[model samples]
Target chain A: MEKNNNHDRFFRELLSDSSREMPFSDFEDEVMAEIRMEYEKKFSGRRNIRLSWLFFILGMLSGIATVFVMSFYSANQPFAFISDNLLPVGIVFICLTIILFAEKLVKISFRRDNH
Target chain B: MDELYIKKVLDGDIDAFRYFVHQYKDKAYNLAFSVLKNEFDARDAVQEAYIIAFRKLGKFRGRSKFSTWFFRIVINEALKSSKKAGKEKYIADTRTESVDPGHVEINDIVSRDQQKYYIDLAMQNIPSKEALALTLFYIEEYSVEEIREITGWTESNTKVLLHRARKSMYHELNVLLSTEKKTLY
Candidate 1:
């Protein structure tokens, strides 16, 4: 139809017209900043993981060394001594629990922050 | 040109990736805008797409032009954002009428400026896929093969989409302009 032709001509003209440039200045800087920040965040996460693993290994070794030293000192009755000092033993157990949970808490917080 | 930046990026130079982003920002924004019809969403989509492309750079494999690979990412992000924003409702409503230019009524002396406005408005209403294809074709002057690459559609599918888009845009513009005239006069 004539109307269709008219409309097609109009569309052709509209499309043929040059589009205005996107109104963004310093977009590259913003994106670069974001990418940089992302890398830093990733690097920090990996560093934290390594640190956590190192701390874990160190804690396990210290625990083993404390047991060895305690057994050597109380070779005659290590179990009886430990039972006799339930308060100190309980405190040590609590501290270990706190440390383990604190590490887990930090990991959870990091995951939350990233997401 | 972009391949050089991509290579540099692959070599662990993060800053070099900026060159590719700077080069394609405008075209990417335009393509996103063509689908989203919202400036802020389009901008966000481009940014997110670029970040995704940067992270996924290792998988690029150089099988296609960097531009094509980048464009596919941008268009996919824009579509996801568009869907999330519920703009697809407008597109669906506008796509109802099969382009029947015979139904249009155009006065002989319509202004170019007016036509341009209606054209833009109509563009916002068409199906997102068609609008995206037409945008790439007209604004970027991309070849059909390039559009096919960008859209991940077959060559025949891309051509058919463009044809449908052209017809749909023509009819939508006529209808929109006629409605505007009725309201104005």
Candidate 2:
């Protein structure tokens, strides 16, 4: 028991008296650089989502404006013909818009999971 | 002071985290070095731990001191680094490094350095968990309660590990000294 106590004291004193200085001088800088990279990654993911939404909205607006102009200019064409062609185009536009929004949602969820 | 840095970090100022890294780097590195036993591996572990802490900064609830929380991360990272590095063979190698203390006289200059080297070697011979507990206890002067908080071990378990560590350390030193004695005789 006495030997054990002595050993403990000796080791404790040795360890406690050892220098506690950091070996790497640039540790802080490396960590901060990593944090900055993470921030940039998150920011870029958000920006991609925003840009996708912006493009989707713009496409939908332009599609609507084209339909309105075609309706006004093509008064001589049969209303049924116009509806048959323009109806599929409008539906496709709406589906594309919904798909774009869903893609954005999926991307955001994936980014969240990765982080 | 850490709280101030945390708040600023949350406020989107990345530079504020520099203060926290500066404050805890040495202790973090020490704990990692004690566990990993290789300076290069320890540095890598500390770097990885700091990044982990930074990414998870928002989850810190301030119930414990930031240093305590951060140290826990450092310990985990160091353990992972050790495992990945296959450090068991390194420990065995240290044990086999035949020290003929019999040939050399212990003097003021040599005893201090020799004792330090032997103690470190003895620590590596023990289980890593116990060595970690001992490091925190002796080097950091942490209480059993603080060790429990950092290691996530139960209070009784912490005490048991500490007890076992001291015993193992004593046995290791005896074995080393006995070898030297044999050489002398």
Candidate 3:
């Protein structure tokens, strides 16, 4: 208790205007303005990071379109000559391939909740 | 109203530059003064921060609070100034306050002015990062997380720096005050 009291008293006195000086006035505005200016000077050198978002969206859109086109093509395929005696098996295989690929695509793209 | 004027500047209202200076110049100046400890250096650092902030205002997406973003700029500017000039310290200006031990009542001797001077003196002697952390934490009363965010340091790093700074100040002041009392007796 005594130790804590002394520590508190010490800070109260240390920050006392009698011993320590307030550095300067209106510190926020003056220094912040200067920093703003410096940021401006450096602006021309580097591009902002948000620009990458456009590329990310575009990539996602392209992948989605490709999957849709592939699925549609598979759905329309005639199984007469190719499937022969194993038509049901061939259709099932195609469906399973698309399902597996879709899972893979989503997993590889966003990478969310991998655990 | 000031924020609106600043918005105008961001919108390319060149004349609003005057109000920009009015709004933030002194605040920036004082912060730099506290960090750099040299009046002229502080003045230049603040001026530099203003110019940088003004030029970069357009790119500000308002994701963070304006004051927080502005402080980031001010801190960078101060650090740069310190690096270049190596921090010229202790300007005993007109406001020089020498707290004689006699001023405070005897009952709270530890909290008295003279003891505080010893603490302050110890603080002044530490590395800049430790001093900066102490000031930002205790004087500014910022939370540890806030200090980490503002200083761009990890939470552990902030805690360690603050702990070390406080410990050093404790030891330094204890020795100083003991010697002071010895002389007096």
Residue B101 of model 1, lDDT score = 51
The 10-residue segment with the lowest total lDDT in model 3 chain B: B91-100
Model 2 DockQ class: acceptable
Instruction: Give candidate 3 regions above 4 Å deviation.
Output: A1-115, B1-3, B13-31, B87-116
Docking class of 1: acceptable
Residues A1-115 of candidate 2 have per-residue lDDT tens digits of: 7755655565566566553568777777888888789878867877877787687678777777777766675576667676668766876777787687778667765663343
On DockQ, the stronger of 1 and 3 is 1
Report the TM-score of chain B alone for all candidates: 0.84, 0.83, 0.72
Ranking 1 against 3 by lDDT, winner: 1
Q: How accurately is candidate 2 docked according to DockQ?
A: 0.42
Best by TM-score: 2
True contacts kept of 1: 0.39
Q: Each prediction's TM-score against the native? A: 0.74, 0.76, 0.53
A-chain TM-score of every model: 0.56, 0.54, 0.30
Query: Native contacts recovered by candidate 2, as a share?
Result: 0.54
Regions more than 4 Å wrong, model 2: A1-11, A18-20, A59-100, A103-115, B88-110
Tell me, by DockQ, which candidate is best: 2
lDDT of 1 by residue, B1-185 (tens): 77788788877789998888878899999899988988888889999998888878877888999889999999999999988987763434444446555444444436677666766787787888888888887778788888888888999998787778876776676668667778878
- Using Cα atoms, each model's DockQ against the true complex is 0.26, 0.42, 0.06
Q: What is the lDDT of residue B35 in candidate 3?
A: 64
True contacts kept of each: 0.39, 0.54, 0.11
